[model samples]
Target: MNKGKGRELRAMLRDWRAAAGVYASLQWRCFHQDGRFDPFLDPATQYRKDGAKVRAGIIRQIVLKHELDVPVPEPVKEGEKPKKRVLPTPPGLSDCLAPMKAALGAAQVQMVQGQVIGTLKSFISNRQNDFVDIVLGSTIDDLGRRQLFTINRATAWFDLGRSVKVETVEIPLSARLLARKIMSHILARHKKPSMKRIGMVVDKRVAELEESRSATSHDLWLKVTVKSGDHRSRRIAIPMRSNDYFSSRQGERKKTFQIIEDRETGRITVGVVTDVGSSFEERRMAYASRAQGPKALDFGLVTMFASDDGDLMGREFLRKLKSIDTTISGIARHVQRSGGKPRDSKRYVAHVTRLRGFITTELRRILNRFVAVRKPTTIFLERLNFQSPELSRRMNRILQNCGRGVLRAKLQALNEEFGVESHEVVSAYTSQTCSCCGYVDRRNRKAQAVFACRWCGRSLHADVNAARNIGSERFRSIGSARRVVRSNVLDMLVTQHVQRNTGERGAPADPRMSNPHFAAWADKARLSTKAA
Candidate 1:
């Protein structure tokens, strides 16, 4: 009795309720014709006119977003964008916006980048439990409509835990007008459209022209174009000191070019610089794969048939209904060992599509920021190899986790067409060897990230040393892992085996595969203790 009384007292004193992370696709119409600025949604068109159904959906999103502790998105202003300005929007909404951009970037993001976009499943935790979310926008629902909450429906699904499937529902509505409508209404609440609005808006105009720059050879200044077609380009400059590391000369037609080299070791390492005219197979593959949608699964009917009056009329009446019906349905993923994979992903199709959308969009953003070339520069990376007897299962799993194969595939295609990646080989002790003291000791690496040399007391990031060795170091002529530059027993066999199989002589895939220098690098760094 006392415990129950205490609980009742606690419930009566709570202040805030749950939070909402509402997500709605944003669309901006260039009201100015010159693409100078995008206006918020037109209230007269969205709320005060024919798009009544669309307005209600937007309102419901608003209520749910608030419930998730996420503040409502402000309207898009005349000159400002939501993503750049919303640097400080509440955390939940910001996170939700990320996957949405990945999943759907004005439909234009999907067409340009041939990859999967992830879903936008926002999380809304309870800040306080005092009250439940009220869905009618700024106004209470009518008595009949209010009952919709008591019986489980759309509103209740938001409360499901992390794994529940909540995706972008294509309601046969226009995201453009819907976005504008939502933005307009939010702006109205502020009396004036503030600068901090539409933090999630992806201007379609900006989306379309961004890929055009990929056509340039990465040897000049990288431009960050904002408000495209309106002639606004914000270029970020990367200075390549034109020395041995970055040098250039005229070709047959006086075409100036530059070679990029290592900063410390003075070795030439190439960077991403694709030819504008080259048709990269990577892009082709991306376009091809984009045609193949997510692997699907199908499920049988799960719910009892409902009557016209909302009454359940079937054998499952005695059982409690699932709070969420058909939210995350799929065929093969959910199928048991005894049950074969489903032929189609009829149930959770929306979720898969949304998730893929998110991934592809994020990838596009990464590409936009890092994939650049002005001077034919180079970067040295240790060769990645998983097909080896030395690799443990967990180590293999970690390599897979890095998605090296996929990443390589992407870069390979890009480089082949553009000639951007000009990787070279130093073939030295990449691991178990110290770049500074020519020490090699497998035990020198006490941790995955840390490497300490016993002979010289020089420590380095294990991976960094490995990358540097593949660029500048040379053959030590020893066939061991105990020196700064030595070859491994595995390396010896691999070079020969590779030659025999492919008739092409190359060390292991790692640039340091059979480099002569690191023969004793590992022995020099070998842990006096036994190999762990």
Candidate 2:
């Protein structure tokens, strides 16, 4: 392409991105607002009621009234100067504002609105657990050869092409003045609209796009539009790694996909859903054929994971994590002393990101190794609550917030990959209770690393002993015990120990119960039983 065409293409891409931003902002407003229909109901039924169109119209009215009320430049006539054009005011309306200059097409706008509604439905249906940020990308349909976006294989590279039409429409103002006033009043009562970028959620046809690529290469050339006419397109070759590892594992490509973009980095990512059940099942069976009995995992800050088999993974994980946390804490303290927000400091933000990245990488590596080496049919884990005295309170909070979620997700991925079953055991007194003799006493844990049983003189690493108890049948049996109080659990453990040692169903007087702690727990248990 010539320099002029190259510049023009760059300009068009900017316009496309700007248009997407506008749509995203509109969707954000619609999602936060109370719509006419319930978000919990069927999204299809809501769409049929023109819910998206109505919400879009409302947001457009507000934007035009407040943000884009300026006169737009009209097309220049031959031998004449370009004129400033203003939209004609509709009957019974006071304002004569035009739509946004970088506005998307009606279909695209409706698609954005539908996406907002669908997000709301999902959030509500999922009991509002996970809240995701709105992403920016135009939703494109796959129409085979005529699709807006297509993936074509070339001699040395793959061509990622998009044919886009940039068209603006003069939306008719049909609502009565009184109705307009009511909408303005309602909008004014809500929070001010914030800008967001367009996000894409594609459904069906992505599988066809994936299948179209018969071969894989490490090169990609993107074809985007340079002009605003009907289906104008231009190709730009850019080199990127093929991400072959992920591509190779994609068993059967699915229909749904996502086109995500990072505004800060200007990076575009395309994610395709794939079904790997059959391959995963085959691997699972192979692992199961050679897998040993169940293993319990005790997670810790010093050691990443300590299994019942005395295997301690990522022993230096805490040292590395604490080093990063110390730096972060120092930065935070410095920022606090300067009366500035830690988030506002570039160094602070970088360190925080680094800490998160380290946690993610370490967790992934450690978990993968554990699953591969142990090859346990089932793994038991305590409900994660990571705390450490070696780090600052702030850093500990960060670890819990960031590390816990990542750990859970990694475990889930392991389950999906290897068909390893994972169960959460009650962590209460796992460290204090002796794995060998089932003795429940706080003093049994002599130190952070030592587990010296007071009853049976059993000694081992504290975390390993806890892991063994977590995997024990006795632990599994009392897993359903209600933890209304600390003493209740202690009494149950004492009763189980007595029954096991004496080979009797009733909790008989045992020599171990001569200890003050056990005697007190037994008395409490008797009182609770009498009250019941």
Candidate 3:
């Protein structure tokens, strides 16, 4: 009876504390914005400010709220112009209170001041004598409302030496059957927008072009006009960069393309950069299997998905997202200059969304091809839980739009259909540890793309090295009570990796080696250890 009274008191205190916090926050905003010291104002303003400050201090004691660290932009160069400042406006009281309800919902936290609420009360009413406090909980109804105190935890003290027995229940699922079920569930539950829409858009654009130009011949090039001030203009040539990686002038122009001038404005115009879908297709095809692997009972596909500096693929994707962010900046600039509509983001947003869809879809398809070639595969993935402050807003946006969870769900569905398995393991130290020598140090990975081990003095591509560690890391087994931690076995494979690139000579190994395999590296490491 006393415990019940204590809970009611605490619940009332919590509500009062929340109300005080809301008022304090509003007062703080007012004082900070408009309540600054003004000699022209009345003396009463000073007293009111002092009282609000005291109230803010008192509310801080009762409320447990932590502020999020907001990111700031980098400083501009010395000669560059500074941006204009914008005035801040405080949100309404109801807007401030809405987040409290969301916070409570997420935590499944509730407080009831008086009597038990609903069906949960009935379940506990029968056992009321045995319990000191009866907690009630319920789901949100169709009316977008949930019962008060619908979720809760309680503290109760029992007589000494009293114990309860718990039973273990087995969920009946065979390895093959489980895989099949998982794959089926994913295929049914996960959905992606059709790519046919993009094709349709492209086809419609082509049809419009044909309708406007009846004299057009069978050619890849199309003419476009540019308008400017009235002045005669001449055609100029623009150069194209070379594709050879080893060429000194790789980024320099080796060939020039003809550019035409507009008759009306005399402004020089060039062809629009489009029809690059073929390039994406080529990149997608590169990830496909060259040859089929031997049939085995188990085939594992380890996916390394992370967004640290060491992640090359992540960094590359971030670069693409950053390029798109330039468009966002341009949009913002346009809005500021013209004082345009505030909510005009549909055009740029759609572009980014479409690009993200293409990238993620291509990634899934590539991974699926690898699985298809090697059936009965178990895919290893890193358990991603936290967000890193080191990631830029652009990088975070790319990751969010890419949808890692969606990819995992799709992989799970693959398991059901193709006997593929997906498993998650702790991601820590995977990028730092050397896969060949088990030598882990911060200096091993200094650059974004390079991993040079300090202890073994072996170097490899950072992403490939991290992927190797992920593929080799120990994982949880079915029916096992605890997760397994595998022992490090760094062996002669380090020597083999060096020799493979340097041809057994003492010279340094080449940084770029085709067909890097983690299993082969493991085998070499084991052999090297035995030879020693």
Candidate 4:
């Protein structure tokens, strides 16, 4: 297309987009006020054909109200068979939608209607559970990802060392003595002093000393140059931090860049947007071809991850998390007593950030280690619940929100990078179910760590046993176990156990009488028959 025609088409599309927005807004408002819109919010309504007529009626009402132009059935002659009646555009709203029709074609108008209906349904459904509001004029653009702008020619380079500044300040003997005294006092107060607390005290003192040298300490600025077309390059100087460095070290530039400013601190930063490489699928497929077998993983607060292969990872994860939680709780309590918001406290925010960082790092490390050691084609996991009686309620909430999402995200990355697929299984009684005999019982779990089956007499680590059950064929065959009640699941397991032991096709026998191996084992363990 020629430049003139291309520009005209672009302008036409822009106008159509605006008109579509207005049309959608009017429809949304109409639906929002209509009672019929509530029923479609039900998840099951989409699967039913009964709502089609109701929806069509609602659409007709909107068409009449907006005076929208719609297809009408033609009338037949007097001698011919009865024909469908046609409706005309209301004279009252004839000119109201003239601009909308002029800019949008039939297909585009239908697209706008569908988009508005879907959005309104979603909004109504979500508003029932959350605080939701309609945001008009925020339509999605059809531009390709990372192709919104065209980069004709540009050169980029990184200025890493040039952004760094180092300075030294002299400390008086009296200030050093006072700092040592404070450290000694802090050490004496606690049985096991935290290095973080001591470091904070020292940093405060150093900051005070540095403030005294403010006349010598000057501002550090970095210059950024930008050129457009034949215009001269414009240079801008931004205040720089000691560690600030360009992220694009390879001198790579993309089609887009953004300037971000921190609302609270008023700190400005530059961001470069880059596209993801297309080789991700190739890498994923390559890993899938090489990897073999499935691995089941049991998530826990103490051990982090337990595998069916009898491996435990991140054994000290709980200990480290607990330590961080202690600091966070302390800071929170102090803020509460002062009647200040926890977010307004710098120390509280810092500790929370640290806690999140630690959780992300540990989760990434454990998952990577598992993939490397197990080399599994597929990973089976259960819905993670990090609630621990040992941790504070706040800490548990944090774990549930941050840890679960971070772990899943890491798993997705692993899938894309290493072709490892992850699946979630129903975990109801896996911890109590014996992996060896398929026997399910609450008494099977003797302790938090130990799994001693009452029926099969099999003994093993509880998490490992659960992991084994999760990866077993029996568990996988029970499709949609999440919908089944726990009691029914237990009954199914009991029936399976009876069938396996007695080779019976009829009613299930007594669990004890069916398993001969359990009888022998029980006799050796000196268990009473009554107890069995």
Candidate 5:
């Protein structure tokens, strides 16, 4: 009900925000987007090209303001300029002011220009809702409103000769742009609390993760149960399969081994791991088939363990034996902050000691504890260039940015700390470079891991060699993802030597092995020794 002129309206908004305890500020860009504007690359460009005119204009404005006792608007420069990079245009000024701005726009357009206007008036500490009120209550008439030019959102007020009727101005979403611009500035400069998505180079090939960015909609809920003596009643979901390894019975079982030849290649084939798990399940299904007719044979994932009344504490014992982990992460901010640093104790302190502990501790508890028999001495792993573009495209950007870098970094770092040398180096040519006969032909390396080398009659396992090569390549380009000369993990000759030493234990003693003349002599010597 108390609004006045155009300038008075702007002043009202400013005074309202201040009076209402709002801390919002204004940013203004003096020149709007126009095609025929001088492109300025650096601050020196503005100084070099429009040094005289711009300086003269500033001086003229200052002198005119001095003569007329008014304040002058600040010049537009970058770097030294503040975070806010917006310039406000008064109503109806965009059409008329386009011509005036065009003249100065010739003075080299600084793309990121901004002016900040605070809430307080020149002569009055009290917030005034309109220009009329400020002018009426001030010692200086025009000077009170002239100060509005300090803010980028109010730059048009000064540029249009400081008349103060900026009502109906198109408020650019400059604050949003300013927020993003400031974040970029911080990241580029590597300032405190910076987040940079730079290349995760391991040798020349950068690491990237191509994964399901979204967590899988968990299906197949695991339902645990126990059967002792025969009293089983409740129904539950099928239990999840776990990798179990236990010792077999000592007595010889009905098992046979024989060599077979490939039908096409006439090549000899080796035996495969006995499907004991499948056989055990089959026996169970056979018993069920007798009890429940035809449908009982459809065992699916169901199981019934033979037990005795002596082992009667059934469900409780099984539940105790079966270990499970409760992972807590990626929750809402409120929960994250509320969780706090795991209550400060030896157990809690160890986990809170940074990501190394988190990764290594969890890796052992989750992965290592389950493996049976001989603990893997040389752990075979596919060295995922988690920083690769292929992986980046496949995986979510957040994981592409953090998961690989953090995981790989933590793994290597933990290896040293825990005295565990369990890591591999991946050759850039894992996919292109053939593992068989050391051939580097990209054409033959089709698909993911199936490789048929043209040079040799050797077929290579893509993922296998890639995994082996990952272990193999580690000799040269170890302890560095941040810097590598090129993607080549190592030259071919070095790779061959490393592979031979690792694969065949330095040199071959058996005659049927590799060395030819030695093989002939050794074969003859063996025959002679047998005769003697």
Candidate 6:
């Protein structure tokens, strides 16, 4: 057994040497063509001339000992698939050694590839010392990893350590301290819950949603079936406009609106096409729900964080960045291999940065709008602190570039200047519980955008519901096991039910209408519209 094991280990070592020799020969051939150490063709011809001869002799011995008759794989032609190989392993070697051999070969290939990239970098038109610095920094961190540093794109102006020339206002960190003082004064003045202040925002949101059906474009309406907790079926029509529309690559788009339905229960909202074009009015209304929606604010400043799906601040923006990064990476790889011009890399990066700027700018606008409308004494956001070592580099990059931190910092500065309160919420389960009933159940949220409580049968838009819950967390005893229902919650449920039924009923069969209740509702709606 010892002899067999020894022989196996020897065989693995032999295979590794053979793979390394094969890679070295390929590298040598490329170097030869590039006119490196010319006139010294064979190692034997030059007797100890340089290190190249000695290294070449070692590779030659390995190649000869292996007695390899295998033809070198042909260079892949443009738009052509390379032939796959199924090389048989030596009898004494195990499959475990395959990876080591592949790694050795890969290292050799990269050595040659690095030389090629170095040659290409010299040809860059506007290459500077800063570019060289970025390259060296990346190489020092992980020399084996591929770098996709684009210098030509529109966003190239935001290069690391470079001064950005865009006009911007500077808000001091001391503004937060001022905001805190103002919030403290407000708290001392009013001891109880600020239900009236919250009610104002809530009333506006509900009225807007109610009126939006008629005001919204016919193309923006979506009819979806969602299941109630009581094992009943319900159909709801919502004025839905998708926000996930930032695609970085040409001909590549992410599915922002996905509806996952439960097969047995049929308690899910589905059948919405997110690609439909949204008008200015439609976009304004959709964003208004979150940006200016009613909230149960216990503090002057509210630190809003994500529930289950993702962070509200930069979800769509991150999706856009991801799309752009994928496209840019592909372009970089293609350009790097084919010896393409630097302009191509710059162009792709520029497009991505422009899209990113638009998202961040819009996010700032929304935050500013919220501060202006709400005029809170102070605000606090639910801080996102979760991190795992298992996460991939790609995922980490996405999270970092998604602009959550940037938005948070911007909101702090903007609110500080306004003397509005701002802070962070360290609580959990912001999305699962119902603000009305205090019911905590994962099943309550049937879909990403739909929330239905099992305890109170309260159904509301998921994000709106979450915002309400987040705002009211400090004011209400959410930890209490007993279900607490509110009068306003009852009214909201009734209104939603009436709207859904009336919508299904469509126009009355008679001019007078059969349902007197609906007729009264219609009369009230008409009066409200005229009042507005």
Number of clashing pairs, model 1?
A: 85
For candidate 1, give the lDDT: 0.32
Best by lDDT: 2
lDDT tens per residue, model 3, 379-451: 5556543223444565455555456665766776565444455666445556667777665455678887678
Ranking by TM-score: 2, 4, 3, 6, 1, 5
Candidate 5 lDDT over 286-354, as tens digits, reads: 433443110000000011111111111112312221211111122222344776543323343232233
What C-alpha lDDT values do all the predictions have? 0.32, 0.59, 0.38, 0.56, 0.31, 0.41
Per residue, candidate 4 scores C-alpha lDDT tens digits across 1-532 of 2354334333433444464455555554444243223322322233243345444545655655566688322323478753223334322222334454445443344444444455555544433222111111113132311111110000000111111111233333333333234333433453421111110001111111111223333333333332222433333333333223343222333534333333334234444434434556666666677676899999998888999999998889989988988988998999999999888988787778778888999999888888877789999888788789999999998888888889879988787677788887778789878899888767678888999986657899998999999899877766543344555566677668656765322343345543443454335334453455
Runs with alpha carbons beyond 4 Å of true place in candidate 6: 1-326, 332-344, 384-399, 474-532
- Which lDDT tens digits does candidate 6 get at residues 1-532? 1344334323433433454343344334533243222222333222234444444445544544565674333334699653343333233222332443253333322332333334323322223333333343332333111112222221222223322221242222233233234333433454322111110001111112222345444334333232233423344445544334322212322222323333223223323222323343354444445453333321111223332222344335444555655665666567778888534566655654564576467657656655566644445444443222333344345445655666667866654344444544433554666768654556778986688875567887676666566566432333221122333333343454455444223333322123332355657656775788
Model 2 misplacement above 4 A? 1-199, 203-218, 221-240, 254-256, 261-268, 336-339, 480-487, 500-532
RMSD of each: 30.6, 16.9, 27.0, 24.0, 31.1, 30.7
Model 4 TM-score?
0.52
Clash pairs, model 4 backbone: none
lDDT per residue as tens, model 2, 1-532: 3455445444543444454454444444444343222333332343444544454455555554466664422223589753233333334131111132323333333444456556544433322111100000112222321121111111000111222221332112221222233334434554433324544544542112322233356344333223344544433432234477755874786655455554434355556678989888888888888898788999888887899999988889889877888898899999999999888888887777778788899989987888788888888888787778888898888788888789878878778888888887777889898898788888888898998987778999999998998899867765542222355567788778767754312444443445665675556556776788
Residue 64 CA error for candidate 1 (Å)? 95
Model 1 agreement with the true structure over 1-532: per-residue lDDT tens digits: 1344323222211100000012112221222122112133322334334344444446545655456565444444579543322122222322333332333332323222211111111111120110122223224335422332332232222222212122432222232233234333433443322111111112223211122334344434312112222323332223222234233422121122222332223233223222434244455454444332211111011211221112222323112112112222323347533365432443444443443343344333332233331122233333333222333343234334433444455556446533445343333444665656554457667685577865457776554555444443332233222222223433643343334343222343322223443344324333432453
Question: For every model in order, what is the number of clashing pairs?
Answer: 85, 6, 11, 0, 30, 25
Off by over 4 Å in 3: 1-316, 336-343, 373-376, 384-395, 473-532
Task: Pick the winner on TM-score between candidates 3 and 4.
Answer: 4
Q: Could you tell me how far off, in angstroms, the CA of residue 51 lies in candidate 2 after the best superposition?
A: 12
